[model samples]
Target: MDDPYKLHATAMPLEQRRAALTALAGKIRSGGTELGWQVTWNVDYGDFTWLIGGHINNIGDPFDDNEFSSETKAVERAVLDYFAELWGIPPPHDPQDRNSYWGFLLTMGASEGNIYGLWNARDYFLGKDLLLPEHSSGDGVEPREPVLLYSVESHYSVGKTAHVLLLETPADVGARRYPGQCPIEGEWPQGVPATGGGSGPGTIDVHALRALVEFFAARHHPVIVVLNAGTTFKGACDDIAAVNEILAECYSATTGPSWQTRPGNGGRPDRRSWYWIHVDGALGAAYLPFFAMAPERADLESGIPVPAFDFAVPGVCSMVVSAHKWIGSPWPGGVYLTRNRYRMRPPPFPEYVGSADTMLAGSRNGQTAVVMWDFLARNSYETQTTEAVTALRLARYTEAKLTALQHNSDHVPDLWVGRSPWSLSIRFRRPAQDIVDEFGLSGMRVQVQGADRAYVHLYIMRDTPRDRIDALIRRLAEPGAF
Candidate 1:
């Protein structure tokens, strides 16, 4: 035998193999941590968090601009410019002033993407001189008023940004998250800007907002109006078109009715004001352009044309979209699109030691960007929309199955109904967890109904097949399974 063992093993190094495998295992475990988060909603994290990259086509991607050799970068440039417009920056303003997609700072995840936009908005709008309140400005200056307005439904990062801004770092941007409803009685905030007084409840109310705009129209508070494209829990969108309408009306006339003080008592709104909409679509925005809000009843197609609410929208200044969750990317990746590149600002913080422009990460792993770019280069709105619609249909189909499974459930004693696809939250009642155990006993692992009075949860996806759906229904309705 001539070195049988070595020759058979092809002289591969076991040490190298061991090292690679160890690294991979650690990655898998870390991935679980993120997967478990499930966008802070925790439950349906299974339906769409780390879906792989086996095929060349996926609705979860929109990076298809890479295929054009004749104008690959050109296409991206055009797209960037389009986004610049979408974010409401005039020509030669925002990111258009500098090249982004190429010299771009790609993020490792959506949080980083949000951070990136936050940095820009903070820095470009506020400047480094007053970044730190405690630190001498090198010229001895006091800190400027730092604030960003968002809803309570907003992710926790806004508060994190505020923490960073309290420091002396130049990248800090203080953020203020507005409670969606009133703390006392579900009312909105009231103030006339420069007056700096609460006009109302400081909450988000359409009519209340109109009143505040009027009350402070003489010159309003100069603040950033950060809007959420998709909230984490409910996945509902704040009306953009209507918001635009509100802004237009408020700015046009400084005087309007106020719920704060009577017109007879007489306090007027300041009008010197303006603001921007920073879209936090970390979980929901990516799917917006392509998915129908209500496939069961809308005249929309697989991907209905939506109002360009990106920078393209008149007042929209920036946008953040997560690639990992809905994009189906592995673990991490996100993109921050902005209109005013110069306006991009970083919060002053000791934690931030690098360029005030790039958010969170000064240097990110290139692999994520490669994957993100690849996804965008190979997918289209139609494909993505169709896939999302398919997912929605799957969800609808699952609902029907649940309906059938519980058709005669009145006699079953512990049977229930369920719903999904972010359309509507629905549930049915059951007395015991025995029916819940039925799924696990049948080898299809599923948790007992949660939150909704103990009804099983489902987040049916686009790829689920009809036959499988039918089988699931059959199993649930199995004689005595309840």
Candidate 2:
């Protein structure tokens, strides 16, 4: 009698367990009400909630054969086609042409997309095969190792990807202390000195970027430029158009007209593009397209100051965007887009899968694709535009409130400052740790010029209401509230 019930029912019964789960759900919902993170993009999956049942795996390429799971591929393609149009990748005409774009749903958020995009660029430029005839002399000599150019404000994932790919060492000063020394563990020497203006905390300084690219191109090394579209910390966006112009001036100056028009018997583009520009638009990619002019408007006279980080920029080779950021998917997933010609050779035919292993991960998340598709399908451009407008409006409103507080509040004189006009993050001096914990605020310590300053960031995402901002501002302005 003592053993019969004890061993079989060590845990609570179903009724009791359900009650505990209900309690947990109430707590989570209460916590969700206080959600303050600007990077969090939560969505209501509604009808698509049924997709969570069973094992849904998107093995192999999304556009190619999917031996494991084929049901989600069509939905995934619709997602890609929508983004391709948004990013300015030309639609495929005839099946024989490589004019269309190629991409896949990434399972591991933007980090995976970043690595995949960089890997493609590395292989395209530094791989054994040469796509374009060199502008410089290189008949028998090997090309210099490709150099990665990104602002100090770029996401940490960029640096991590570089290290993981053995591209460069992070924060390692190789030859300074010891003469003729290489980094011990894939660490590069110190990076370029940080400058002010766009180079400060968010955006990239185009002049500094140009100088770095020229420094590398002068030595015959191909360059990969990671342009930030809405940086992680301060929500800064690099000048993609300016960067493109700099590429034309810095990297391609040595070549003549025929340098790009190598007599390829076909009517394809010549190899004028010497370097690659990958837009890390984890936050802004989904948001900017709403403000941009319709793709048919070639003159680009939209009057919107939005920076072009898409195919409209001739030098841009690829872009990585996180659906989990602004697009509001359930899980961490993203989209990686590149030209059809620039895609790396996939692994040899996997007989079992009946498709080449082109994507970064083998067993992809088909459910994430469906979630994204549901979100995208329900929200048209008009709906997204309305939401984008509201978010930015609230962001500006929050900044104005903060600025007023900085001017009036005695306890906090220099309270808040906004980044670029297009940014959504409003950074200010850090408040008490209790408030930070209460509101779920994110903090960072950054070095500006010579001084180290602590700042708290608030990202004004879609769901963030005006009342929430007002409440935070009021709490921040309260007297004796350090």
Candidate 3:
């Protein structure tokens, strides 16, 4: 076979290129049973096929239209409005209202949102005016350098974002990566340890987090926390409400007279602590609200619980949700939402775009916004509730079947199987390589009951039906499957 990864110096014949694409499309259709990821496979954008012919770019802010006539800012605004209302923050009624929500469509999924949110938090605490020159001075008490805190279970993007933003981490400070602003910590060298052995798997330990926040808050360092609404592997959500309470407590403790009374004594009381909470809700934020609103649809009596991790929670400053995860899109895209009060002022407006470049990527895909709008408009609140309920029900059914296979099998009597609370994924002993490839399963190695074990997980999406689950179970029941 020719090297598919290589690019030929000369362009390929049009007939040959068309034949290759047609063959690839057949492969994709045949492998549609791959249900190991959190993406909805049953999506058809045939009505929007005309968009491929035009070059549409949503340059600059989604709420503001640039000179480019082909932009879809209006549809993008409607999409943002839908998410803002869903996440418990009202949409921007007026462009000048600082209290209303302000955000833009993301081109690179949740990673871009994470970077943008943390970048804003870092600048906000550092007292750097976004619209001013690099060395321009600010008119407030200069805050100490900020520290980044996130659970070990968070997506890899969080740690990468920390590095990109130049924020201090436990490992960075210990290795003397930079000036090492925050004091050294104990036990959590990589990141904040998560609770997995206990009932709340993949969730951040609130007590441990509170202690860490207090240690930094007392030392006068601003803190930035990245909470997970639905983790990648285990699908766990951290307790945002509990973390907010801890921040409030630390804030009160740091603002005492002992820290406030300085030599400057400008008669203006100063706050000694600053904190920002950004929720990385790539999977859950898109559909969890519907589960919350219609709890009667799910089997909540079985102990699975849905927690709040949006703007409704007092301390949550910003959040990001992927359109390709819960809500299916042809390509990777998402939205990053934050209040206008928290939006960092962009650098001087660009005349080329005729609008302020507030978004991370100045040029974004207008087609993503239009697709998201179409999905939201076609699916009403009740329809979303039904879909969410149905997905959860299928997940429960799969878990039950897997558990039965473990108990009933004599060859693999000790088969390990588990699922986190309110999770759409189920973990079991890793099957043979052929079965894994056939079903598109994701594999991981973890310590289970004090021993290393290989596990594979299956994510139940809207396209994952009961028959597909049965087929997966049948493959696992084969002789020597484990």
Best by TM-score: 3
Give the number of the best model, judged by lDDT: 3
Model 3 Cα displacement at 177 (Å)?
11
Q: Which has the higher TM-score value, candidate number 1 or candidate number 3?
A: 3
lDDT tens digits by residue: candidate 3, 1-482: 88543558998878778878888888876755787888887888789898898999999877677789998889999999999999998875355665578888888999899999999988767654423122212233345678899988899999898877788865555355334443334533558877754223788878767877887777676788999988888888888988988888886777432133122223333232278899999998988888887859345526555787999997788999998988988889999998765666687889888988887888898888988999999999999988888888888888899989888877765556777777788888888899999899998887756778887888988677789899988988878887
- Name the 10 consecutive residues with the lowest summed lDDT in model 3: 257-266
Model 3 vs. true fold: TM: 0.90
**Candidates 1 and 3, the one with greater lDDT:** 3
Q: List the candidate numbers ranked by TM-score, top first.
A: 3, 2, 1
* Regions of model 2 farther than 4 Å from truth: 1-36, 40-42, 92-96, 129-142, 169-201, 255-273, 293-304
**Which TM-score value belongs to model 1?**
0.56
Q: What's the C-alpha lDDT at position 359 in model 1?
A: 38
Could you give me the TM-score of model 2 versus the true structure?
0.84
Tens digits of per-residue lDDT for model 1 on 133-241? 2211122121233345555545667556645654211112211333342222234432212111111111244554454434333343334555666544334355556
